[model samples]
Target: MRATSIGAVLSGALVLSASAVTAPAAYAAETGVVIQKVSVNGGKPIVLGTSQTESFTISVTASDDSGISSKLAFLQIKREVGDNYWSYHGTPTCTASSATTSTCKLTFKLDSGWGVPRNTLAGPWKVVVQLQSKDGDLYNNGGDITHPVLRRGKLSVDAGPEPVAKGKSLRVTGKLSRANWDKRTYAGYTNQPVKLQFRKAGTSTYTTVKTVNTNSTGNLSTTVTASADGYWRWSFAGTSTTSAVNAAGDYVDVR
Candidate 1:
């Protein structure tokens, strides 16, 4: 079945605060499953070095013969660091009130310096979503559902000016950005490696020629000589766990 596309809004000045402590609520008697659509907005595969921010929204619609009343949900972000795992340490960054009609929607900002740990890689990251009653009953799978896991659909990086040319040596510099989701910037390079693929224009295929690690700033730069250049293109790719697949950035025309 085709999934619904959720829209998100992005802002650089938005700061998401954790909700205060509150007692959990009892589960709702609803019987139908909650259908949600998740998407990233602002920019895909965020660029490295450049400071960028993205927003995400989860629109939920639920119907049950039991009649749904409570309209509260919990959202959390989890990232993989090295061999271990880390989660947003404090309170939930996202919450939604019950809709007066039938649908409930919540939005949050993932800033560059949000909840990211000091040490995070540039590879695949995951965002684990959970829907629960303030009381504690699971929403999706009855009591069996502990969390709703939806991996980021796509992650990408954007490097401006693909076929950057100087004099003779082709000078290319681009920023790395993540798409389909937002990430916090750390003090060093991301745990994942950024791979660059390049091929002369006219070639039927390309090859992996260079690789670089996104620094704390998520910026990368490289220079290569173009031999008898017709046209050339370069690509940058990376991935994370919470995100469903890999992300990429591309550049072209280095003559």
Candidate 2:
């Protein structure tokens, strides 16, 4: 068959013909799976600080005129960062029972700990989703018979807290905002957890301060009362399990 962009025919209804003659049919060889919608339920862009759990839903519709051949189609998700990769299977958190024809749905919950690396640069992160046929040949003729897939959208990243003054009380705050795929703030501590640490400005020995949680508004603020008066620096560690992004903000003061 001819090669066509999977995203082109993802919407509306589709018809396909089933013939025993092999060697690849046409663009109509298999039923198309359309990703109807993707939503990050509570908040988008979740903030960078403390641990937070966020939920999401992905709606999809599939149909074929050649009859439903594969009933066990599955959805796959991944976070893209250069050559690094993190993948997860979409769980069926919700489903429609009365639906007929080749219909498949999947649900996914990505924790903040599953996000960008602590040293990640400020920019956009990507989440990719794909569908796979369970019991069918993936390759047909010259083209692959893989299920249709799409790059959902991007996640925004920002700096957290860093450079703290020694021997004085320092306040650190941060905000989480969405990007690319509809902005949202995560609910509860389900987002990534924020890690705080300090060290002498010129030294490398780092000490743990405190790891705090962000409020519903994706705001996280904490006071660091130091015991000594020396050049000091602080760092905010990021995780993928919660909604906290890897970031760092620095401050200095003389006491």
RMSD, each candidate, Å?
Answer: 11.7, 17.8
lDDT of each: 0.37, 0.34
17 in model 2: Cα distance from truth in Å?
32
Q: Name the regions of candidate 2 deviating beyond 4 angstroms.
A: 1-49, 66-72, 91-103, 110-255
Count of steric clashes across candidates, in order: 37, 43
| TM-score attained by model 1 | 0.38
- Model 2 over residues 53-165: C-alpha lDDT tens digits? 43344333332322333333444433445665445454333343333333344544348444422323222323333333333423112212112122221122222223434
Runs in model 1 lying further than 4 Å from the true structure: 1-53, 70-101, 110-194, 197-225, 228-234, 241-255
Cand. 1 Cα-lDDT: 0.37
**Tens digit of per-residue lDDT, candidate 1, span 24-48:** 2332334233433322222232222
